[model samples]
Target chain A: EIVEALIRGAGPSSLEGVRVLLTAGPTREPVDPVRFLGNRSSGRMGYALAESLADLGARVVLVSGPTALSMPRVHERIGVETALEMHAAVMSRVADCDLFVATAAVADYRPERPADGKIKKSAEGLTLRLVRNPDILSEVAALDPAPFTVGFAAETERVADYALGKLRDKRLDMIAANLVGGERGGFERDENALSVFWPEGSRDLPMMSKTRLAAELAALIAERYRERHAAST
Target chain B: EIVEALIRGAGPSSLEGVRVLLTAGPTREPVDPVRFLGNRSSGRMGYALAESLADLGARVVLVSGPTALSMPRVHERIGVETALEMHAAVMSRVADCDLFVATAAVADYRPERPADGKIKKSAEGLTLRLVRNPDILSEVAALDPAPFTVGFAAETERVADYALGKLRDKRLDMIAANLVGGERGGFERDENALSVFWPEGSRDLPMMSKTRLAAELAALIAERYRERHAAST
Candidate 1:
């Protein structure tokens, strides 16, 4: 049994029979019928992750926000535009999965009141009141018999510290953190680096193409997931 | 001279030697390093116009906002992110153009004080103060030796009245109005209809592909431009 577990963690079929529910892309919070408050996520990293996990024989269900990317080959894909819709979609499928990854840059807040029609340019200055959106990752992690929940944090400063804080505060199984707003290796780019953290230890993934990075991250996740399963069983 | 002018308006080389400046896509207003306020323009119509005008032998200089579309074949293409950047690019080149078409859906307002870093999700509610961006079309039309200025109006209600209002108020030579926010034929769609209004007359362009619409609009613009030039000199 020990040898089988070791082989499973190192092989391509490491995640075979594991079910994953993942979210990707940036959610657009509507300010009106035409305008929206959005972020700069291109969804490449998350899409790559989905593909990598599926290559390991995992059944992946992708809950995606508005993006120009074509659908990745997964068990299912649910398209969503806003944070609320994505939240609903994810919650509906969370129960059936052994793992959940929240990689989408979901809006932290949305306009308190979105205009039905296009808002006219009548005001010299406009003040928009924004209400906080639900914390999808925290909620999923807190579920009874929760899956191994992993979250992504894109920060401009203190990348590792913030990622660790989120992992602890949200009671998540793991967190992958990256620095954004720099000249390279973040949002809108095809390459990135990650500082991955869990309760026990952390790993630094050097800068590389998102495809290669996803494969590396998937391997780490499979190993950790198998270890936890072995200990629990 | 009359026969020459008539043939010029009807032929493919109608705009031979004409210098055209056009703007396309939707401007993004930064709320922070990560978040932005944006609209739903696909930049298809403006790109189509650039292609059509270039086919008619015009030297097209396109000032474009960030979009997913590839570069259209034109004499020059200036890519911009914010409304202020777009305004600067257009103003710098306006003096050299014979015609200016504003197809971009520039943001009406931008966050007054954008944060240098990503705003944390600590606050339950937040208020964003927004200030109006420069009216690029009006400023260009107000230039001393302004090009034959044309504007596009996307309205949710009273399309004709608002379009006529814009033409008269802005002192524009022509305005093309289209209805948006419906189930079909606006913003992100490839097909659209236009109600084009000038000082003395109006023309209704029924629903068609943006490519066909651009060709028709270019012909009308060429005819009107020739008439205006003949009357002037």
Candidate 2:
């Protein structure tokens, strides 16, 4: 068991020396002094992916948002709270990466103007004006010499359709889709499953601990990345 | 130092036999299958209040939203994630309590109808139709045999005006207001201060660690509760 654990911890060699960038957790968009917009992302999947990549000897840059999980041992870790901060971090590091995985549950919108202080509650109710946040995956894909981009659609309905749609629309080389909140509820859980979709093919990753699933997914990513690199060359 | 720690942890008997209800952390409003509207509240203030109350021999029912903190050893601990859930929990327990502290940073609005599936990113941006969540503080005040309700206002501007306004509008016995995001900031930090207001007068609680502030506030609440009880008798 000890040897098995050690071998599993070390993982594969396909990604040796490769520079990989990944994102995790939920970005917090400040709404006021004490509060900010966020989600229930635990950052488990992305953390697991980072761990697996690092185990495989990849130079990993894990750009993470606010989560309770401790930092993973990787080449670099950039912690951010807001979606805009995450964008800046990813952009600054993209040029040096060989692959990019957009896994953080990034907020699609943020309060257009977060009150400098806490807004007092009113009987009349409140209306918050919000602006769209940058589509991180799309922006990365639009880069002149972009890294192999993998995006995801964690959905509850029509997972395949949405994943494929995002894959095509964002021009992502691959996408992972999953059903959120059920027997395997996505929020704040330790386990997850995924359906990875690529241009001409797809595969089902069965339900398991997030760590195991991420390790397997990371291996798949390494193989696919190499195939793409060879084909392009 | 050890003796001081022990004394602080056990606290005084000022609130002996009291039953107290507190709400802490931030409520989540689901926007889609994989995402929800939320805020950054560490629940430090509320947790501190719970600890102090528990320390003083009061039975505490901590109805909390999402936070990373571990559960305090009190009479009971009720964990919740959304505004509605927190409301339900508080409403169910209010009849048994002599004091109620609405300290949770409940989200004022929630999606009118959250999508069952993940929302696909749109080019023109997406607008979420939101409706106000039920005012838990106001509802508790309206109870036939209401507890001595204490409301909190963590604000950026017009602190006193807003806190007083909420106290009247919600028919609260007392209100505590604080300036959020300054050197102390109000969320996810260890320290805080408040300007507590009653209908007849007000007092300032100086800056201190959340735990210390809570203990001091708890003492004040015990005194105020006794005064009210004596006058009613």
Candidate 3:
């Protein structure tokens, strides 16, 4: 199996000292204690990423939103909810990391004024005031000593075009694309398909199990990281 | 929510009917009763697509492989394993579809001889015969009456270059790219980020819940599908 082969390739002593930072799951924007805006993100993809990175022998720091996924082995796991909390967590320790990945479905907009308690339901139509959340990926990418930064683009049409624009706009080193709309294989599904892209080129990992993809992705990341590092040095 | 705003913008009842075909998850190639080869895919992204399509009032046909996700409510659902199975399933019914998305992660290789029973482990490391699997996306794209085809790429580096390469090699109408690393977001995590690309331009979804991204992707897909359809006609 490729997993077995990959394990062998790493040897017992390989990847012992690598460091990585990752974010996972969905962020909640509270409108009231009983009401909040959120998306249906299970954090599975982020969990799998952490596992794969750990397997590669990287000491990982996982900053997560609320998710059912168990903490991956070999990582410092921190849990948070709101986008602000995530931002704080990420910023606090982003330095000294070799890689940074932002996978959390962070709420782009949050209620400007969160109600202290359950909002009373009235006959009148409710209007909400929202403000934009911080752009986590962009913020990290703009860092002085940014680790290899990667972003993702999940689009329905003009997937390639839009993704490339994001890479340039966000100033990301790379990006991934997810095509939603399938039967049993999208959000909340156990399988997925990914397309990876960079400024110069791109490749498709096709659809596969997330676990396997994570491993392959980790190896590829290691190789690329080394190449970029080598080139810079 | 953006959904409410979009629907309102479309003028309630404007989208009574539409059709879409989406592929999701990762194909598996069996080597024995206990062993099979597959890609790392969580199917979350595709499921998100289905959800967004449904929300937009499209009657969706979702073709998928094995995944842990529940099937999004749709007009039709077909499930299969292996690339060959998925290829047959897609070809059997793709003729009438209005839009086609090749999102499933199909195995590139399969064991030539799948053991009827679990193969006994031998003292010496055994080499299993391998063969190439059919490229389902490319095959469908080559169809005489091809539906609007969209392809995906998951790469570690040079995402744009590689994605563009796939666009040419596979002859796809569009492509999306995702880089896998950091957290579990790429494969199994609920939240994901994306970069949408095509021949013309690109955009970045940034990090967000797959569900939210799915909605945006669907809107874009629907818009582009209409444009492409109109151009062809």
Model 2, CA-based lDDT: 0.84
Q: All predictions: root-mean-square deviation over Cα? A: 2.6, 4.2, 22.5
Which regions of candidate 3 deviate over 4 angstroms?
A1-233, B1-16, B182-184
TM-score, each model?
A: 0.96, 0.90, 0.49
How much is the lDDT of residue B221 in candidate 2?
A: 73
Off by over 4 Å in 1: A1-13, B1-13
lDDT of 1 by residue, B19-110 (tens): 99999999999999999999999999999989998988899999999899999999999999999999999999999999999999999999
Model 3 Cα lDDT, one tens digit per residue, A1-233: 99987776665433457778889887866655433555556788878877887887789899999776776774699999889999999999889688887778776666678776434333233445567777888899999978888776655456688778889988887787776434534456788777787777787777788877777666666666666776899
CAPRI band of model 3?
incorrect
Real contacts recovered, all predictions: 0.88, 0.49, 0.00
What is the alpha-carbon lDDT of model 3 when measured against the actual structure? 0.73
Question: Per-residue error at A89 for model 3, in Å?
Answer: 30
lDDT of 1 by residue, A1-233 (tens): 99987876666448989999999999999998889999999999999999999988889999999889998989999999999999999989999999999999999999999999899998899999999999999999999999999999999898988999999999999999999999769899989999999999999999999999999998888888888998999
RMSD to native, candidate 1 = 2.6
DockQ-superior candidate, 1 or 2: 1
How are the candidates ranked when ordered by TM-score, highest leading?
1, 2, 3
Superposed Cα deviation of residue B55, candidate 3 (Å): 1.5
lDDT at residue B14 of model 1 (Cα atoms): 86
Query: What is the fnat score of candidate 1?
Result: 0.88
Clashes of 2: 2
Runs with alpha carbons beyond 4 Å of true place in candidate 2: A1-12, A123-126, B1-13
Q: Rank the candidates by lDDT, best first.
A: 1, 2, 3
